[model samples]
Target: MQAAPPADRRRRRADLLTHIVLILGVLLFALPVWIVLMGSTHDGAAIGRGEVPLLPGAQGLDAYRRAWTEGAVGTTRVPVALMLWNSFVMAMLIALGKIAISLTSAYAVVFFRFPGRMLAFWAIFITLMLPVEVRIFPTFKVVSDLGMVNTYAGLIIPLIASATATLLFRQFFLTIPDEFVEAAKMDGAGPLRFFRDIVLPLSRTNMAALFVILFVYGWNQYLWPLLVTTSADVETIVIGIVKMIGTESNIDWSVVMATTVLALLPPIAVVVLMQRWFVQGLTDTEK
Candidate 1:
């Protein structure tokens, strides 16, 4: 057989190098998750003794079962199931609420011709600089004054208005053609009908992308949830995981590992399920 040309040989070497780098990157990120998975199957004492489990243990899934039903024995006894539910509710509510508010707000800002329209848009844009951290005290005061503390309303409502989402939706809206607006008006479709019929269908992909991002944001929120919630009934999975990792003596490593695994499932499921829409929305070449 004839030997491969120099260019072909070089291309093969480059492909090999690229794959090696990709594999190494995967291992770098996945190592901790593998250790946690193996650790969760082992006895808590072994982990506490600094024994990093690299293989499966005889404990099987008991740790997970205990974690799911019993919860973090070190910090509190609220069930992992309840915490997961609370987190799901908070994330879903926040994601949906932000999308709804951002969609309408952006629609009005882009489509309407009110006085100070640009001024209103600038005002909303300016709020992006004032994140929840900066306004935590005043926001908490408002929630507290309204008797929303330790309630779902307290956890979800305060986090629902996202300037980032509004900005993204506004940018997307501006790309829509003026002809579509005029066509809808000529057809006697009111603003709401035009929005419902024309805009929403065109925005499905973007909404899916934003939903994934906002869901993860709400799911991973630590400080805000930590501050606003004092009741176990409204405790999120992230907070529960932190609570599980208390003073070393109180730490049940197996339970913590198991809880961590459980906490990761929902967000992973969402991403995996909506991956196509998420990728398309972010990297759309057509529009």
Candidate 2:
């Protein structure tokens, strides 16, 4: 048999060390989620009393059912299912809205050379420095003036104009070869037609990646929803989950954990489902 090379041995050692470190990291992150999952399966009294079981308990199904059908104790009266639906709708609207607006804005900036183009780009980009928190009062006044309070439009529209998304799309557009645009022009394609036929198709992966990110961001919004939605009908899961935690004496730990698990599932699923496209998009856009 041939002797193993020193380089091969060193490479193997490095691979083994990398695997060990990654495994440790995974366990570290997963530990809290595991505890939460286990806690959700147990009785509220057990969890509240600090008797956290390592294994799944007999109350798993019951806890999930209660959390789904009825809101957590001390939380909003809205059911978990309803809150989940509302969260889904809000997330989708925000993601789609951001992508639509960003794509068009970025395309115009990249393809058109109209007057004040750079000025417009800079104006939009400057918003990135000022987060929603800074302009909350003014934004709220605008929403209130528009009669959008407690409505889906109120929740989504204000948050949809994302400077980061616009920037990402702009960067990606700058990288597209001019040949494609020239070819489209040669084929008698108008701006809108070229955008629909060529640009959008090229942007598919980026859109998927952005969708995953924006969906999670929207789903996790707490302050904005709380500010805009006075009605329980439009309350998101994040807000609903917080409302679940009552005073120390009244808190139902098991139910709260269950609701947390419910809240986490959708974003997790979205990321998992779009993992391929998301990774590809990130890598491609960087070039």
Candidate 3:
């Protein structure tokens, strides 16, 4: 073969290095999941005794079955299925609620002329500083007074007002050409009609992006749900996993691994399924 150019050789080397690094990164993350998978098939006692098996054991798949049907090993106050259901419902509600509210709020802030409009937008933006953790006490108090405590409403409603979603939506709305607004007005379309027809269609991608984020946020919620719910009836899968581990002595290593694997499925499924929409929403130049 003829000698290649230096630039071509350098490019080839860089590509090789990049692939190697990417493979390493993938292995770095995948290794732990592999261990967890293998460990889930072994006895918790064996694992507790410091056996770190990197391959599946003869324990079969009963851990997953027990986790799905029962809450965990020897703990069945709430089933994994039920907890998964609660988390799914909570996540869907929070994602949809945030999208709906942020849509309307951003529309008003962007298109409608009103008193203190900038102030209103700023007020909403300022809330980004105050997350649920910061205002947990008063938030819990309000929920308590409203009797929403331990209810799905309490679980979802408090967390649905997303300042980040509102900000992103407002910025996207700004990209919309004034000609569209003018055209809508010329067509005798009112604000609501214009919003329904023009803004919403344009916002579908952004909404998808936000839904992926907000759903995961709702799914992974720990503190808020822990404080809000006192019953297993409203238990989230995350909480169920925590309870499964328990203290060091009573920890069911195999079952915990199994439950963790189960818990990971939903968020992974969501991200994998909506990855294209998520990426497009964030990158689409059409806004």
Candidate 4:
């Protein structure tokens, strides 16, 4: 056992300092989440009164119950529960649909080389730079043309072609040992079979990570859903929240805080549960 040289010792100290800085950065990023949790547990009055509570007291649950039942402009006066269901259903469908479509497109681009492969890849990749706001009006018209207005198709179909997911999977698939694809092909595994038996299982971590990312996207979608859905009949949780802040005077802070808390649960649970997969996906993709 020998002590490090002076130079190496200083290097180690530098690394330690880097780690300390990184930890502090992480805590700073997490502060807003902590605030949301705290705010969710308090009533509108307490929150408005600046009574900052650190923990979830019994009163917090009571406020949550009230928010869940009659949080302003929720469908059926049970905005929290109603919006939760809407958000869950929409998020799930959009996430699943985007994954399925992205996976298939990525597989095609990765495994099967075509004449215009690079062109197609570049075309889809180009959309990544174009913000949704740029083409939303045309997209709305397209959906309207297909007569999918106010329907699930209008909400989910426009989002099915996630360029980011396609790129992520394509990059991941390229890293897979080519021998696996070769072996599947030798065993008469067609494209579909190859995808089913080889690509998907190996790509589960990436898919899970992508799922969380896209689920959050769908869950927090406001503009598209608002434009497409006419009323509470098919409105999402976010839409309900906006609706709560009516044009008239006097917004109910209590109901708003309560609804906000309730709305936060699904995405928070999603991030917590799939966190390992997300980490693995990022690591694997980085490698």
TM-score of each: 0.97, 0.94, 0.96, 0.82
Tell me the number of clashing residue pairs for each predicted model: 0, 0, 0, 0
Candidate 2, which segments miss by more than 4 Å at Cα? 1-6, 285-287
How displaced is residue 161 in candidate 2, in Å? 0.4
Worst 10-residue lDDT window, candidate 1: 243-252
Which residue pairs clash in candidate 1? none
* Candidate 2: residue 257 lDDT (0-100): 91
Quantify how close model 2 is to the true structure by its C-alpha RMSD in Å.
Answer: 1.9
Candidates ranked by lDDT = 1, 2, 3, 4
Please report, in order, the local distance difference test score of every candidate based on alpha carbons: 0.92, 0.90, 0.89, 0.80
Candidate 2 collision pairs: none
Which candidate achieves the best TM-score against the true structure? 1
Residue 276, candidate 4: how far off, in angstroms? 1.5
Residue 252 of model 1: what lDDT?
83
- In candidate 4, what are the lDDT values of residues 101-128, reduced to their tens digit? 8898888898887899979988999999
Q: What are the runs in model 4 whose C-alpha is more than 4 Å off?
A: 1-59, 73-78, 246-248, 285-287
Please, what are the lDDT tens digits per residue for candidate 1 over residues 141-184? Answer: 99999999999999999899988889998999999999999999
- Rank the candidate models, highest TM-score first: 1, 3, 2, 4
Weakest lDDT window of 10 consecutive positions for candidate 3:
70-79
Q: Is candidate 1 or candidate 2 better by lDDT?
A: 1
